[model samples]
Target: MNTQDRLIESTRELLWERGYIGTSPTAIQRRAKAGQGSMYHHFTGKPDLALAAIRRTAEEMRAKAEAQFSVPGTAVERVTAYLRRERDVLKGCPIGRLTQDPDVMADPVLRAPVDETLAWVRERLTSILAEGRERGELDVAMDPRATAATIFAVLQGGYVLARAADSVEPFDQAITGVLGLLTASTPATRE
Candidate 1:
């Protein structure tokens, strides 16, 4: 890869592990094997490089999510497929992780990609929930936006729990529990 490519890749990796505030131009230069001049030649600075990296990661994540959620299946099937999609459970969602970083949130350019990614995910899930409600697969009283946000929160919260416990069991249990709640709420299946 070129100097620019090397720098961007290194930035993404460092950001993944240490976040925006923790990553520095020196660190990225060292990781990329590029000189300070070469690094500066490609990006204005660390923030600029991180912004590019964030956008790239966001696009990758969106594509990955769409692959499963857009597939031919019922709402439960789609949700289950998305929740069960293989992930670095401990690493968590790339954008989601940034939400916790004070620096990332403070910088408008840095936070844009993270916010956009999360908003897109919630909107996509809301559409799915709406379809389910219409088809009677889900209860009519369900508010698609709120329910989607809740589902999104559960996944994000699950990552926090799993990382805190250093075990995947909590994440697995969380997903399974949601699946049960969603399926069990069908009007026909009411107790």
Candidate 2:
């Protein structure tokens, strides 16, 4: 691969492993097998390289979600399916992980892709829920956006729990718990 391409891939991989704070230019250069001069020749600095990586990851995540989120199915069926989709619960959501990173969260440019990607995912799921409400599959009173955000939160939180417990059991339990809430109706569960 070209130096620029190699640099971007390296950043993506590094960010996944160490996040923004831990990924250094030297490390990136080493991973890419490019020199410091070569990296600087293509990008301004770590932030610039991170932006490219974040954007690439964002697009990839969106595409993956669209595959399942936009498919034909009931809201519960789709949301549940989307949640239950195979994931590296230990590695966690790459974009979601950025939310916990001090550096990535500090820079708007660096944070933009992560925020937008997650927002879009929630919105997509919300739209699907809205559709289900129209079909009477999901209660009309349900706040689509809030419900969507809650689902995403549970997912993000599940990653934290699973990582802490060093097992997928917590992740699975968390998902099952969230599904219980999502599937709860009669508007009484809120009480």
Candidate 3:
């Protein structure tokens, strides 16, 4: 890849592996195999490069979700597909992990992408749930906004729990628990 591309990609990897505080400009240069001069030439500094990387990561996450949501299925089925999508469970979420970093959370510029990505996920989930209720797949009384937020929170919490335990079992259980609750709320379950 070109120098600019290499720098952004390296930043993305470093940010995923190490938060903003952990990823130094020197480390990015070394990882990208580009000289300091080259990095500075293409980008103003670390923040600029990091923003680019974060934006890319956010877009990728959205695209991945969209792929599952766009598929032909009932709301619950499509959401189940999203929840069951293959992921590097042990590695944790690339974007969600950033929220734990003090530096990332402290800087509005650095945190915007993380915040926006999560909001997008919650909003998408809410819309899906609303559709489910409209179609009578879900109970009409179910609150889409509340349910979506819960789903998002549970997923993120699952990552933290799994990472803490050093096993994917907790994460899988969390998913199963949420899915079970969602299914139980569906009309099919009542019928």
Candidate 4:
């Protein structure tokens, strides 16, 4: 990778491993194998590089979600695929973890991507549930917005629960529970 790319990638990994307060310019340079001069030449400073890294991470998260959503399946099935998608459950979510960082949440510039990514996920899921309801795949009484929010909450909460217990069982159980609830909502014929 080029100097700039290396710097951005290194920052990304560092940010994931360490929050903004914990990641330092020296550490980024060391990880990237780039000297101070190269880093400054490629970017204004740490915040600039971190922003690039965070945005890249958010973009990748969106693209990954889109991959699942675009597949041929009913809304619940697509959502199930997304929930069951392989992940490093113990490591927690890259973007969701940022939400816990005081520095990241305190700075609007740093928080924008994290907030936007989460909102985007919720909105996308809402649309999918709405579509399913319209198609009679889900019960007409189901509230798409509410259901979408519930699913999103369960996912993030599951991550927290798993990490707290140092086991993937919590996350698996949460996914299974949510999937069961969703299945219960399906139209009788569809079920």
Candidate 5:
């Protein structure tokens, strides 16, 4: 890859492996194999490069989640597909993990991508639930926005629980529990 691309990519990986405070410009340069001058030439400094990397990660996360939503299925089925999608469970969420970083949370610029990504996921899920209700696939009484938020919370919380326990069991259990709740509430199953 080109110098700028290499630098951006290296920063992305480093940020995922190490939060903003832990990732240093020197480490980025070392990983990218680019000189300091090259890095400065492409960007102002570490924050600028980190912003680029975080934005890229956020975009990728959105695109990946959107793919699951786009598949042909009822809302519950599509949501189930998304929740059950393969992930590096122990690695935690690339974007959600940043929410815990003091530096990332302190800077609005750094936090924008993370916030936007999560909001996007919740909104997308809400849309799906709303559509399902309209189509009678889900119970009419179900609150789309609330259900969406719950589902989003379960996934992020699952990651935290899993990482804290150093096992994927918590994450799997959370998913299973949420899936059960959702599936049981579907109109078809309810009737």
Candidate 6:
């Protein structure tokens, strides 16, 4: 890749591996195999480069979710697909992990993409659930907004649970539990 691209990719990796406070410009330059001049020439400083990296990560997350959301399936099916999508579960979420970083959370610029991306996911899920309810696929009493929030919570929480236990089983079990709850709420079809 080009120098700028290398720098951004390196920053993303470093940010994922180390929080903002832990990722230094020197480390990023070292990882990118680019000198200080190359980095400064392409960007103002560490924050600028980090912002670019974070935004890229957030965009990728959205695109991946959109892949599942746009697929041909019922709301629950699409959601299940998203939940079951391949992921580096042990590595945790790139964006979600940032929320735990004090430096990232303290800075509005760095936090914006993380906040917006998560909100978008929840909103998209809510719309899907609402559509399903309108189609009578989901129960009439189901609250799309609430259910969406629950799904979001379980997905993120699963990542934490799995990481804490150093196993993916907790994450898988959490997903299965949530999926079961969703299935149980599906309206029964007439024979």
Give lDDT per model, in order: 0.89, 0.88, 0.93, 0.94, 0.95, 0.95
Per-residue lDDT of model 1, residues 44-94, tens digit only:
887889999898889999999999899888887898889899999988777
Tell me which residue pairs clash in candidate 5. Answer: none
Model 1: pairs clashing at backbone N, Cα or C within 3 Å:
none
Runs of candidate 5 with Cα error greater than 4 angstroms are none
As for lDDT, the candidate ahead, 3 or 5, is 5
What are the runs in model 2 whose C-alpha is more than 4 Å off?
186-191
For 1-191, candidate 6 gives per-residue lDDT tens digits of 99999999999999999999899999999999999999999999999999999999999999999999999989889999899999999999999999999999999999999999999999999999999999988998999999999999999999999999999999999999999999888977422
lDDT of 2: 0.88
Residue 79 lDDT in candidate 6 = 94
Worst 10 residues of 4 by lDDT: 182-191
Q: What clash pairs does model 4 have?
A: none
How high a TM-score does candidate 2 get? Answer: 0.91
Q: Mind giving the per-residue lDDT tens digits that candidate 3 earns over 1-191?
A: 89999999999999989889899999999999999999999989998999999999999999999999888989999889999999988889999999988988998998999999999999999999999999999999999999999988888899999999999999999999999999999998998
Listed per model in order, the count of residue pairs whose N, CA or C atoms clash below 3 Å is 0, 0, 0, 0, 0, 0
Poorest stretch of ten by lDDT in candidate 6? 182-191
Q: Is candidate 2 or candidate 3 better by lDDT?
A: 3
Candidate 6: misplaced stretches above 4 Å? 189-191
lDDT of 2 by residue, 91-124 (tens): 9888888888999999998988888998898888
Q: Give the distance in Å from residue 66's predicted Cα in candidate 5 to where it truly belongs.
A: 0.6
Q: lDDT (0-100) at residue 155 of candidate 5? A: 98
In the range 1-191, model 5's lDDT, one tens digit per residue, is 89999999999899889889889999999999999999999999999999999999999999999999999999998999999999998999999999998999999999999999999999999999999999988888999999999999999999999999999999999999998999888877876
Ten-residue stretch with the least lDDT total in model 1: 182-191
lDDT of 4 by residue, 1-191 (tens): 89999999999898888889999999999999999999999889988898999999999999999899878999999999899998989888999999998988998999999999999999999999999999989999999999999999999999999999999999999999999999999988455
